[model samples]
Target: MAVHHETAEELVEEVFLFGRALKLAVGNSDSSLLPPALTGVLGMLSIHGECRQTELASLLCLSQSALSRQLSDLVEWGYITRTPDPDDRRAALVRVSDSGFEILERIKESRVARLSTMLGEWSEEQALAALESVRHLKDTFTDQARHASADYTLIAR
Candidate 1:
């Protein structure tokens, strides 16, 4: 565990940076079914697929009661489906629905459209150069982060 409160703050700062990067890269259009507040939850589900509610809550740093309420809302909206976990009958597994996938696709399309509009004023060479620079920055961060404190790896997703 990290002994310093500064570590917690730094971790949070990085998460915010990631969120900002995502907003810039994918256009921050919030679908009614998948509101901005719930983006991380749904995005995690989208990336990891079905998972038990307890595990999902742990991953999201949420309480089981809180996650259950949120999941209920998603299920009501048809954005996600909930089912009994096969291995644990008492537990539930949540998965994104087809409608959820469709909404995600639409959001991605909006991101592409927005990116095009933003880059329209830039010359092709300028845009390409910016892309390469961003890629290198990303690679540098990844490479340097490999030697971070072992606890960082535990908390990093």
Candidate 2:
């Protein structure tokens, strides 16, 4: 079926609205856990294994001090660890600890179950297609943001 042009914007808005709703639902489900930013940091650590604080701050779009506070909190909670960097003694590398990975795994399971329930009515093919489209859209948005940043730098000079 051909999608109406006017409905395109509505579709985008609905996607964002649903995303917000999902986030709210997940946040409400777990009260004692870390905030979303900390959760994101843990997830990033899970994927990247270990990384420098500066790199993590850049990846997370947070100021160094802000990231430091979050990392400190995680360390205090025993969800992450900071060790002296092997390559640079002056620098520290942060990694998600075993406990952190356990928490992250639980979060992943909860998210998957919740999303599965929400999309239970959807056919597997339809859901996979939608997932692929969303992935592409995210990548495209990232690329556009990078280009815009480059343009801004040029204009600033």
Model 2 misplaced stretches (Cα beyond 4 Å): 1-15, 149-157
lDDT per residue as tens, model 2, 1-157: 9879889889889879978997787755543566777898888878888999999988788899998998998999999999999999999999999999999888777777777887889999999898898899789879999999899999999
**Highest-scoring model, TM-score:** 2
Alpha-carbon local distance difference test for all models: 0.77, 0.86
Question: What shift in Å separates residue 61 of candidate 1 from its native position after superposition?
Answer: 3.2
- Supply candidate 1's per-residue lDDT for 21: 83
User: Which tens-of-lDDT digit does each residue in 15-99 have in candidate 1?
Assistant: 6896698675654555543665466677678898999988788777799888788888778888899888898898888999998
